[model samples]
Target chain A: MMDFALKTFGLTKSFSGKIVLDNVNLNVRKGDIYGFIGKNGAGKTTLIKIVAGLLKPTAGSLELFSSSDLNKQRTRIGTIIENPSLYPNFTAKENLRVQCKLLGVSDEKVIDKLLDIVGLSDTGRKKAKKFSLGMKQRLSIAMALVGDPEFLILDEPINGLDPTGIKDVRDLIAKLNSEYNKTILISCHLLGELAKIASCYGVINEGKLVKEITASELEEACKECLCIKVDNIEKACDILENKINITNYESINEDTINIYGDFPNSASINSELLSAGVGVNSIIKKDKDVEAYFIDLMEGKTND
Target chain B: MINLLKADLYKLFKNKSFYICLVLSILFSYMGTMINFAYNSFSNAQSMYSLLQMPELNGIYMFKTSFRGGMLFYSIFIAIFIASEFSWQTIKNIVSRGFSREKIYISKLISCSLVSIIITFSYVLVAVLYATIKSGFGKLPSHFVLNLIRMILLECLVVISITSLFVMVVFLIKGIAGSVATNLLINFFSGDLIVLGITLLLEKMFKKDVDVNKYWMFSYNNIFASFSLSNDVVFRGIVVCVLSLVVFTAIGIISFKKRDI
Candidate 1:
């Protein structure tokens, strides 16, 4: 069996008696890009912080590889929790050099190769404070990989990046997972980009993880929704309920309803509505994105 | 442990405030020795009678005068280093990198103490060398080595403890402004009041003989006093140094561990 990269049992944390994470249990398997999705203030950052050993959990047990052998294992784990943690006064090369020195990695060529990977090899002599937000972010990721970490935990890595920068990071994450075979746990608010890259997912809401699934299973579960525009939604619902036997539908308004499930029979439904004297305006098939799936999960309406 | 020490030293070297304090120390100590020699040489000018009541220009007096300004400056410098790490949020990064908090705390304490110790020792060496050149070393006292070593070690322990106190303050507030303001206030008004006031209150309450100078880290009279040769004084200085180190180090460690850094 592949090693379990990270595991937390009954993890809970509170500050000033206010709960930040309430009984959170997390499992991250090796060689998987597990996208951790949550809204703002949903304890995503807190969970990452605890795992990184930056904050002690109030009521939980965390055990990594034994410290005696941790140099071999822990040296392979990298992280960037919340904001990019780097000295703004130092150059990108200097920052990475310091990280490498901390890890006892003395290879200059390795540092250069890592910088080349992040496309920051030309940032020579330029302080991090002078770099743009995108450059600084890329440099931070490069720093995380200083020791050739086998597992990388990145929290909101693309929080403030532009579309291109987001794409760059998304591609980098994919490359890291696929090419490098690194077990990655990334928390991001941008579900759309996360959906494109993540192989597995954990949906957290209100400080509780409601669901975890593989990408293929999520793809199958989030079936297409048919957006139907009709003059009378109630009549359409009646027709769908009676003749079509379709209980999977939502009424958008008095004049429109979303028909989902069994998409091949859409033409039949249109003709059926026409024959039933129901004025059908349009029917559009819409695939639920990560956000819609998360909403469904939160509302307890997710497809099993 | 060596890596930890190297990291601490790296940080200390990078900080500009430490360099500025170091330069001030060297310059002031040199000036202090030169000025005394010049005064003695010009005593025949009939202008030095008004300053006759002043204490003798000894090695301890010259060294203290030269280094006192830098000592005060060193306090602020150490405070700034401790505060800036938290203020800039770089400490979170370091803590997250899996360095034990206790190790990090000890590293800082070691760095601060080393700086203080080195500064004091260098000042004394300069004062002695300059005095020997200007006014022929008059048979160096037998206890000179013992007392000077003890004095420097005492200053190191006291300054390190002071810096560690401010480290806790910085950790508590998690900001430079809050830590610096609170420390300045406490050091200037509250700390002295607590020391002198408590000592005086106890003396009056119990009709005991209390040496006010003995109760505080600093003493104005002691700074300018003549250095007499005595093994007892050196022994007492060693005890004071050990006590301060123990007390301050314990508090510093406990406070750091309990902090939310």
Candidate 2:
């Protein structure tokens, strides 16, 4: 059996008679970067808050490290939910020191190491309120990593970071998972950035988890294809199948067809349609990225 | 819980607002001593001392001089120190670390109570020392140390109970502005406006005289300055303090547990 870091069953949450999380089930395996995706009010943060014990579930339960005793099991977990849990007047080191005391981490040297890890070592005497947004985020991450928690849950860690800041956070997350042997559940709006680090994904929409897919599975689903719009649908299919011998194609609509395979470029496909006397409106090369897949999922266009 | 307390104490000492409140209370306490000194010297004379009277500043009422106004500063202290945990979301760091909410609530209560005592006694300490310099420690009642200790313990209970009430207000409001405003409103009005309103309403409804003083905390607080309580008053003070502490703590814990962080 696969060891799971976090798992929930039929978890539901409601706020003042309005359901925020509706019978949601989520699974995050050990040692995997699980990217939680959703729009605003999609229950991503709510579920994270519940898992962190900041909010109580209205119904159902969850297990951390496959144990029903969440209170005991949660000690091995670290989380950064919504904003960075910080004391604004204190410096970054001071903030981490408090976290250290709370977590019973006695190694004072770890403070310097964590500051160095987050590239915040030079921020001496600068209070957290004086730090820039990226610095605040980095300090929060360092604070979360204080006790070397096995499971880390970060809600929108890179929400408003610049490109460099985003890359820095991304690299730090990847390093923490790779070098530290940690399991992470992170939610972010930047799907492209998340796609770079997440090994698996959970997509939630309208307070419901729509799908859970691995990176390889997502790569397959979002494979590069050639999209062609034509006037003649039947003739185009016959010509493509018989003439081009490409059977891996999907008919998106009456006039549009998406062909997926190691086929020639869009120009070749376009010429093939024209040579067969089929009216080809347009033939463009399409690389469906994570953003595209997410849009399709949100729009309910995908059957899955 | 120990670790949480250590963290809370670390925060308590590091917070600037705490020192500000402490200094403000001490200043007010010293001002009280100066006013008493002036009143005893120049009560009948027409001088700057005539303008210094606030609610008849006669007799070296050290406890009242230090405590009544000092409690107002404690309101701001408790509100800022506790409520900011919610506003700044620093509480999440502890709660998400797997510490039970009950432990967190209790730890906060202990810290707030301890700090309240510190603030309250510091105010008293300033008055007692200053008054000793100006006009020695007055006549010692029989069994002076023992009686003083007893008085201090009762005052501690009252202070804890009052701090717990402020904690409940902060938890329920959970915002700095709202919590601070409500705490001040309660501090300024609970003793007079609210109790007076209740007294009038009860008298009119029951068609008789009913003394609500024994049942209310401020009523007990008013009598605490006397530095000696009869068995009856001590029993009633203990009952009122214990009851308020339990009720306020329950409400605070319930409010904290039932909400979404």
Candidate 3:
């Protein structure tokens, strides 16, 4: 708990008597890029808004850095919830300067530093309303970096970015976490991109946080299996069970055998199968990526 | 609170709409002063034979004219400036920071009042310029500078109260169109109805002659607009305006704290 940047205990919220975040318990550790995943209207924004102090929770509580004073603790955090809440008429530099004032930071160098970090340093005198969606998102990130907050909350940070923009933001998030040692709670629809940058993930479905697991745990759950198709199913099964002594393997179908662990390689397996009377038709390895894994998780299914 | 106020000031100065509104208000004040001068000149011509009953086109009288129909412009300015915070969703950024909701509301109130009062004072200056050019700043009530200072100090309370009312309305409505429409309705319909209601209530209860309008802020403002001054009315106006400012601000802060952005 001491190392955790944010932790919520049964945190709940509702609108018009309809629950939007139901008994959600989440933990985001320090220096971690935590990815919050949910479909559209699955309470992702509601939870983020609640944590960002934009919405009030109906029940339960959340702790930022295990402090009794939430507001004081909140000063150590920053957010860009829902859409980027930016002054449309101010330039990017001017916007950061305003945020600097809000955070009570006296250093003017911080403004230029933030703009440079977000790659908006050259966009001088251009109103934020004239900026593209990607530029606005970058500027929002820069605004959130004001006061040099330790924890950053970015809700749907890459909601509408092009691929290159997405990669840029992804690289930036990674850099912020690795180089600056900042804790980030980013919610995004791009699970594939998130898998590349996030250290862990929280999957929410229908307002309930269904799963919270680390990348290693997700990788372990979606581990690959060598599936071999053979002509003589009975002989292949007997060889896999008795000769190779591979107990973790299973016969997936009449002609296909799945080897879960302790197999030398596809080449050895193929040679062994050919040495036997079973004719090896094909050998393929299959595993689920983050999107497939998340979909299955959302649908209450496992990778297996 | 200081940081939030500073940020708000930064945003206000950088905003184009604020400057546009400021210029428009000053231009309108000058135009209105010219029209008042023409009408007052016509009345003077009609009363040229009656020298003793002539109207004073002095700077004090012109300064009082600024309070009349000035609320509409103040309401517009308040709506445009404050409502944009919600409409543009920029308030959420501030709220998400460590500032308390009360601080945010108070910061907005202070900044909005500061800017609106400046606009109001600008109108007064413009009107005074017209009056100085027309008449040599006529003396009134036997004490010129002291009475003028008294009038101004008394009126500042009411001006802040009016600004507070619009701030509360914009905050409660939480949108540009709704708050603007509600403010306009209040300016058009509220104070007179309250005065009439209280008048009828007192008359029915005690069969007494009473003037409830004198104690009412807006009604007293109308009375003050004629440069009509008395010690009792000034005291009553100050109390009512201060109390009204407190009530309006309290209601706004309470609602803002409980509301979801």
Q: What's each prediction's clash count?
A: 0, 0, 0
lDDT of 2 by residue, A191-298 (tens): 999999999999999888888999998987789888889999999999989988989998888998888878877787788889989999888778877898986775
Model 2 CAPRI rating: medium
Please tell me which model should have the higher lDDT, number 1 or number 2: 2
Best-matching candidate per DockQ: 3
How does each model score on lDDT? 0.72, 0.87, 0.83
Model 1, runs deviating above 4 Å? A63-75, A225-263, A266-286, A298-304, B27-52, B56-60, B64-69, B122-139, B143-159, B182-199, B219-232
Local accuracy of candidate 3 as per-residue lDDT tens digits, A200-300: 99999989999999998887666777878899989988887787777787776788777775667788878877898789999988776669989877776
Candidate 1 on A1-304: residue-level lDDT in tens? 6567877777888989988888887778888899998778888888888777667788976544323233234556788877777777778887776676666778888878988888888988998889887887788899889878778989889989999999988888899899988889999988888889988888777777777888998876566778888987778889989988889887867887876666546799899899999999998787876678876776556443
lDDT of 1 at A70: 31
| Model 3, residue pairs in steric clash | none
DockQ of all models, two decimals each? 0.31, 0.72, 0.73
| Candidate 2 Cα outliers beyond 4 Å, as residue runs | A225-261, A264-287, B44-61, B192-201
Q: What is candidate 1's TM-score against the reference?
A: 0.80
Candidates in descending TM-score order: 3, 2, 1
Clash pairs (backbone) in predicted model 1: none
- Candidate 3 positional error at A184, Å: 0.6
Q: Tens-digit lDDT track for model 3 on B40-116?
A: 78887888798744467778677766764456677777888899889988887888877899888888888887777
